[model samples]
Target chain A: MSTKTDKIDRLAELTAQQESSSGASLWREALKRLRASKMALVGAWIIAVFLLLAIIGPWVAPYAPGQQWRGEVFVNRAEFVGARAENWFGLDHLGRDIFSRMLVGARQTLLLGVVSTLIGLSVGALIGSFSGACATLGGRVGQRIDSVVMRCIDIMLALPSLLLAVSVAAVLGQSMTTVMIAIGVVQIPVFARLLRGAMLVQGGSDYVLAAHSLGIRKRRIVLTQIMPNSLSPVIVQATLSLATAIIEAAALSFLGLGNPDSAKNPEWGVMLTQAQNYADSAPMMAVYPALAIIITALGFTLLGEAMREALDPKLRG
Target chain B: MSLLELDDVKVHFPVKKGLIFDRTVGHVYAVDGVSLSVEEGQTYGLVGESGCGKTTLGRSVLRLVDITDGSVNFDGTDLAKLPAEEMRTFRRRLQMVFQDPLGSLNPRQNIESILSEGMAAHGIGGTREERREKIRDILAKVGLPANALARYPHEFSGGQRQRIGIARALVLEPDVIICDEPVSALDVSIQAQVINLLEELQESLGLTYLVIAHDLAVVRHISDVIGVMYLGSLVEEAPSDALYAEPRHPYTKALMSAVPVPDPEVEDRRERILLTGDLPSPANPPAGCRFHTRCPWAQDTLCATERPALKDVGGGHKVACHFAAEIAAGTVERTAASVVPATREEMADRVVETPAE
Candidate 1:
């Protein structure tokens, strides 16, 4: 066997290397792939535009979104001041500016999607972390705890989402909190299961075995080593959950359970609810909110899917 | 007494079936009744093929995998019966260097965290600064730059990562380090560098090692005592020079013949003992001698019915075979045959009895 020490000297020769981002190789490589993907860029663009509109929409609107001015000399009952330069997207049957209402509605929609997703992600991720740790290194009692926790989650998953919302609403009176928490019911199980599964996989990985061999305590191992590695898939799920929340918003709007302040707050879902009443003559009104929700959902979905691909070890070089 | 003595070690993993109410249908005899010892300041190499119990045997020493039935006596203490909390404390004195360099180090943790976390857990140093100082010293010993502490595992080459893996083991200052296939995953030239590094560290640190590997050349190069394993048990054990000069077990003889000789003439003329059929699965191992299922010199009557216990031949050399003396003395004539023997059908019938896992 050759005993040349210079070979190892050359191996560690890159000690003068430039410092990169703090994220691990997995995240850095995934971020690089995301930056290169056309789909991610397009999705990011759509999301950015929606965010910008949500932020500056009220300032740019020509009229107050909730107010209806009857003296603005409207046209026929069916077609009220159709697409004029003065009122823009024209006056609605209630004499309010539809375009301004849509603009201000962007913030409400974004908030609805974001708040619900955040609630689900935080709660589900906590449950997932606990259950995953219990199952992986907890031995007999830990497995039992994981089994009970997962069974509860499974039962929650099996229940109809509407009933989950209604039950939640019953406990905490029906308001903005109820709507957001209820809408987020769809994501709890998905996040918990995803994080738990990720942790289970990393638990079996050689690194975790190495950690175990190091004599590090089991609790510390779970928190520091296992938890960090198990977050990629959960982050991707969080993004996808935003898209799900948007779809849930549509369904809630159809059921007239959307935005309790349908008149004052004027969310996209609220606008859609009002549009259905005038659907026979004003199809474009219904089309606007539907298209808005679809495009937003598509943006989040595209980004989430691309992220899933980027994080997949099988796809990496 | 030897620094590490394992007597009748067994690790049987239960094969469970059915969801919900999981039922243990059977057991996989991973490391069945393995007994060996490693003295302080000496390297004991355990060599075996893919499915052999070398890795499992190494793991059970540190209680990474629980020992089913045995006593692992280490420096006067019985490690096998140590409580989990006590095992954690015991690990400070007994560390392990893993196989995969990249897979062993946490991808998310930097070199500093990776090295220091163990020291912190074991309470090696008094303070954070003391720990960092100790970690730097270890990094230097393992041939890594002081600056490497800031980098992640993926930043370094395979050989460098191995150095860090060794450093992680060294930082613990364990009396005995179990290196499980340490240099097998590295490049050939790099393997030599890593091996040299390990040797240098062992010399300087006065550390004992139970090095497990499949590469015969690598094992022979560094080991003081070498054990050849088959299925889930060791078939032969001898000093490095004695085992290489003359391998008594039929399976070891086959392995020695497979090693390519440097001399061109000898390489061309040397008779190769090419055994037929796949290695029998450990889940359902052969009835008698584990290697008898594929042994060329296997006697039909004794090899298939009675298990062979490892017995001392002479001068510390041990062979677990029914006809070890006869095989070594050449009294039993070689059966007339090609690589595939004439009694293939008989062997096949015997092999068919134990269904592979």
Candidate 2:
């Protein structure tokens, strides 16, 4: 018994020592654990490179994004690759530089993903959290709203996502902002359901109960304690959702719901559409844009999976 | 002035039945019109079986659970009448130590953040550093090393986590604390240490406690007054010694007899009043006296037809029973005694004559 007590004392002393020591910061510890997975690191690097390209692409491009290079049309694709120097990555069907168009397209794709996902997350989080916190009539109303919203998302999901995007974009009329709003509207239900599920889980957690016992305001509890804890999963979901949003935007652009497909303006999806007619002679044009879509989506999906694993405690061990 | 008073507080949860489309149901009376009070600097212990509404009563007192009816007045302020903002202020003065130490404290938060959160929320401490210092002081008072402020809750043992729970409650400098079975989760020796720690803190901080537990022995050691609850109602309330020495209510007697004495010889010798049936469903409790179904000396008509109100017989010992006087006088004997065969009785008598201790 004395030895057992002595062991306990020793354990307590060690804990006291570790608690006092500033050995590892929380972020550093999380990062160290995260880095142990090579796939996750690679995914992170891909995301970082894409983000950098999106931010600085305009400045780094040799020629104006919309300005067409005066060169031989699709016939002199090989010559244009080295001939103009500005027409790097060869020329598109309209003799426009594919590399510059891709850089510009990256800006549009990222903007659509980031803006739409933010809009979706904010609106869904608000509705979901408020519904979770409400009692009596408000609670019932929140539940009804959640069901109706989720049902609408189900209806949207039932139709091919691209088809829905095409129809919504056609009705709203073609513009980048219109495309973003269309994507955001479709994405809201996904976020609402995610936030509501997370809120339900958090509502039963002890910290939430502790907050209640302290008589903290329901609003404060929802905003501070519950919301912060729920964010980790939401963030991973958001990353994957952004990838979907980008793909949907590309689909909308391909279906003539995006920027006008004139000689000066060539989006990656529009480039693919234009290249389809000349597929036998110039297959590189279609292949390049398709590759961009697949690679970008892959980057996001890998990052999302990594983040989900890192944030979920059950999965961590 | 009484620091806290619960006057016939009833918290009933509606029990719904049937499929998703249609349902008809009744109410599960979790805390059915139970009344009790705690004086300033006094520790009131509430003992009962698991579903006996002890926890419900504690939560009702803190206004954590919505009381279906009745008034909970703390320092003359009607808890139900207090506006949301005022109730927030009231909460700073009234804290709670939850049963599960691990569940009570946030796993993500360190000890310092947990201890300082209540103070910061109530705007009690002057500055950040002052709050941190206060946290350090409270940690030390709980017998935890001061440096433990930086540790996460998972790093500590069950006993230490409970101490952290205590520290969190005390750091608020609350006038009253509702400890919901704080040490029941700990080991036997650890339970003693925690009880001692609680007593020491109560004396030093002048803390009033409504300590809820199932263990009668722990309640006897720490409480000034003891309230025995059955089903949803408080069947008995008296001073600790008065209740233990001369239990008035039949339910209280049965409960007291059920507590396992440490001395095995005395434990064996003592008449173990075994309650035959499991506790009745609260949704449909036994008619009249809730304990009447299991009462050894239950008189048919009075036990079934009429509910007994908690009335003080004398010396502030209150019991809610039709035959409190008879039960208090020790006139009632186990009904099973006469039913057992002669051989079994002889063996039982021998065991009773020579208890484990």
Candidate 3:
């Protein structure tokens, strides 16, 4: 039998050796595997481009978005290149620059997507984690609360998300913050359910049990052990949820629920609304904003898929 | 005082109907009236077939599975009565190593993070360096290479992961560890490696263990005292040598006989005791003695009608049988022995009759 002193000394020596080695071992190998995923690299580039567009898009446009460029003839051709000077991508019924409007529209769409998702994730994560932690303490109370909350989520999920957002926007009045909150509210259920399910799975795992055995606090275990483990699935869900939020925001805005009376506002959905009347004369007006929405949504979806694959070992190659 | 004591602990879960409108009809009694104790620096082995509540008993001691009734006193504190905040403080002294090494450790965390997580949660160290130092020391003690700190769980072999799981438990300098079928999930050769590691760690650290497993060979190697569980109750318990040499409980005798001897020569000559049938469902266990349906020496009228208390026959050995002395004295041979084709067959019949009840 080895003495505790000897075990302690041996442990000290081993730890000292690990500290001296630096990042010369397995850290380098993990970096190599991350670099090898081609799709991830491509996804990274796409995200970078969208981020760049969102940052500098407004400054580079020739004309202010939503400002009418009078006397500019509308271009009718669907196959036009990036060569037009007056009303670039041709004139909408309002004679606004479609290219300029699309650029500014990118900023609003991206902001709405990111802000709403963050709000959803934070609110939903808190509710879900609290529900899980409460399940451990007030067993029956937690279950009843969980059922009520989940059923409410189920009701929201049953309705077409666009319809839910429109009604919420209609109730709260037409504004960007209202649209963001409406979209965020619609997304809460998805995050709440995802986090709750992940928590249930983590709550049963031995590591969590081990944490409990060590006399770790219920809050600490839920936050540190349960949250970290559950976050991966939540993250994956949040990524996909962002795309849906962006779509919902656009739908609400298109239905005239956006910032009304801001004639200078070039929100993507508002831009689509203005362009719909002149679809034949300037098809690019609708096409450019529609394409922007699809591509940005696509970016989040791909990133979400990659993250889900990376985090889930069962799904990993 | 005993370091840990459980008096008639039970863990039951309501079996909800799968259908939307199905009512909660009954409870799955995962553990029923299990009572046992472990002294400081001693290894107590809990042996039983799967679903016999061996794992459930271990989990309840940790309060991982909530106790439906009774009390668990750890170092003189009633664990079930402790507040949530106080319970967290109590958890650092007791740890658990699970059955599946892969399933137990978080897949997202690397070795260092996983090892250091317990220390961080319990606030064991004052600074980051102190925690890092503690993790480093534990990795080596478990025979893991120090450089393995940066690697994820997937990068390691099954044996290495089990070692990591052990390191996570030991890093906290815990007083008691409940190993729930720790080695049963590993390969045969790897099981020896893990068993040796656990024994070596125990000797060095004076760690007390509540080792739950079905593998008797592994149990015999590290256990000072062994408790045999059937359904959800401890049917027999005694020191390792005493229990193996002259098992008083018929269930234990059948279990000991079932352990395959390595040598073919001895294997051919030695008499084996086989039990019949699978474990009964814990949701609706049989009336009277839980093991009555499968007890080889079961007196149908007496065994089926009376639930025997765990009585001390002598020498700190306890057996819960109406006829324990008769069985222990060799006055009663298992009736199944004559009817069964082979000793192994009789042992199989005995184990199956209880069916996890």
Candidate 4:
């Protein structure tokens, strides 16, 4: 027979190892894994810098964004004022300071991105949770309710998202609020479908049945157990949607369905639109705003992808 | 009266068609007409093959699934007829232990919260300290370390996770615990420990159990009374010793024949009853006696046309079969026609049709 000390030592080591990890939850463990990923750290840093710029861009801008003091010097047909010391980033076709417009535009872009995402996330989560709860716990009548809600969602999903966004913006009339609503409305079906699917899976698990048998109130089960467990995918979708929302908002502005008062508070998309007239003379004006938009969208996309990996059940062990 | 009496329980799920506007095409009678009772502090084991509705029956006890037509009389009141709100309160005395240990406990919750949740819902303890004391007491009874209360379900081994599930049930001081395939998910070595823990808990706490499992040996060991399910109904039920000593039903005999005797001599001497054909779909179950299609001693007319009642054949042994007496007496021989391949028409009819509801 083998000696027992070595086995005992191994067992003790295992025990100590287990003892060291007290109350480490799925979320906490995911957070730890997220911290370890360099991708997540880089993405987080980009978002942090972007948020800082959004908050402080207006105050730091050298000139008033709406002022077109160098109008006479910036004749689009004959002469172009390239980036110079006096007017860094040069004057636009309308002779507004290009650098100052971009800086102030940062705050408006951030507002559109966050507000649209929030609109989509909240409305979608509410609709999804309602539909899921009905389907899972509502018995026969609940099934009917789910079918109705899902059919409506299906109709929304059937339309091409960009076309749908365009229609919503066209109907709402041109403004920042219009673009936000349009993007938010387009994201509704996606968020709703994801949350419902996740909740359906969670609702069928043994814990849900266990909770039911425990005589926990059905409302409490739906709210506390089912809702919390089903939120991860929705959350991942929200982050990814943020990037999409920003891009879509810019597209709306470029299409002239965004803020009407472009000269006063110039958005990047509006700048790109205004720059189209001076394509031969001032190509740099379009290039600057395009780069800004692409980089910001990239930041959110990276963060979203990193979060998806961290939260993945396959990677948990 | 028995502590829990399930009288003529049935659960039928409707088959629906159409995307938005649904139509009830037919019904899948999942748990069709099953009735059994359990005594206080007695372990009533239910053994069945897969897809035999044993799990559904267990769920029906707590009304987790809708009871089509039945009277689930628990401690004098019919739970089937109780208001949903009242039933929620009444669930304090009844609990369920699930097959999957990890799946049963919330992955995000600590053992303390998992155990205390039921107690909090039932209003068992007045204060947090009182609940924690009770929870700790139960954790010990289930053979878990005190430190385990702070850990999540994923941290524990299969057996330990099972204990946490049991602890969650026990915290509410439930009188009856329906263990649905409790030990099946565990490892062989771990299965015995969990089984022993269940027995120990029963003896110490005077807890009654309605255990649903497929393992014959596990059932015979712990169950005072054992019921065997085929399709959605009980085919045989008797005292554990009596059922093992002499299995009366043809289906029971076939099930028992599968269990190999440890001694080589005895094992070789025993006759093996190998059943032919797969289990018919519950949606279109055989017309009458559910087991008639594959029963070794199946006759043409009576076995196919008429459903058999669970009749007592002396010594508290109940069986649902027309030829139980003749077969037990060694008079009726095995029919070769029972094993015959299905005819072309029969094969065509096997595809279940959606009947108008």
Q: Supply fnat for every model shown.
A: 0.61, 0.42, 0.49, 0.72
> Which of candidates 1 and 4 reaches a greater lDDT?
4
Docking class of 3: acceptable
Candidate 4 per-residue lDDT over residues A1-317, each given as its tens digit: 25698899889988996866477888888888889988888888888888897889999999999887655554635577779897889887777788999999988888888899999899988899999999999988997899899999999999998889999999989888999999999998899989999999999998998888888888989987898789888888888888888888877877778889887777777787777767777789788888888888888888888888888867886
iRMSD for each candidate structure, in the order shown: 2.7, 2.5, 4.2, 1.7
Candidate 2's TM-score reads: 0.81
Question: Candidate 2, which CAPRI tier?
Answer: acceptable
Q: Which stretches of candidate 2 lie over 4 Å from their true place?
A: A1-29, A55-104, A130-168, A261-266, A272-286, A315-317, B14-26, B245-250, B253-258, B261-278, B294-299, B313-315, B324-357
Which candidate number would show the highest lDDT if scored against the true structure? 4
| Clash-forming residue pairs, model 1 | none
Q: Across residues B1-357, which tens digit of lDDT does each residue of candidate 4 receive?
A: 899999999988888888657798988888888888999999999998999899999998898988989889999999999999999998888999999998998887788888888877888898989988888888888888887878888889999999988888888888999999999999999999999999999999999999999999999999999999999999999999999999998888888988988987666555677788998898889988999989989988699999999999998999999999998888888885533334434455665443432
Report the Cα lDDT for candidate 3: 0.79
Q: How far out, in Å, is residue A147 in model 4?
A: 2.4
Residue-by-residue lDDT tens digits, candidate 2, B40-85:
9999999999999899888887777777899989999999767767
Give the runs in model 3 whose Cα sits over 4 Å from its true position: A1-35, A66-88, A136-138, A261-263, A278-285, B14-24, B108-125, B147-152, B269-273, B325-357
For model 3, residues A30-55, the per-residue Cα lDDT tens digits are 33544666655666677778888778
**Tens digit of lDDT per residue, candidate 3, span B241-326?**
99999898888878887877899777755776667787999988988888877777887567888888999988989999999988
For model 1, the superposed segments whose C-alpha errors exceed 4 Å read A1-41, A71-81, A158-174, A309-317, B334-357
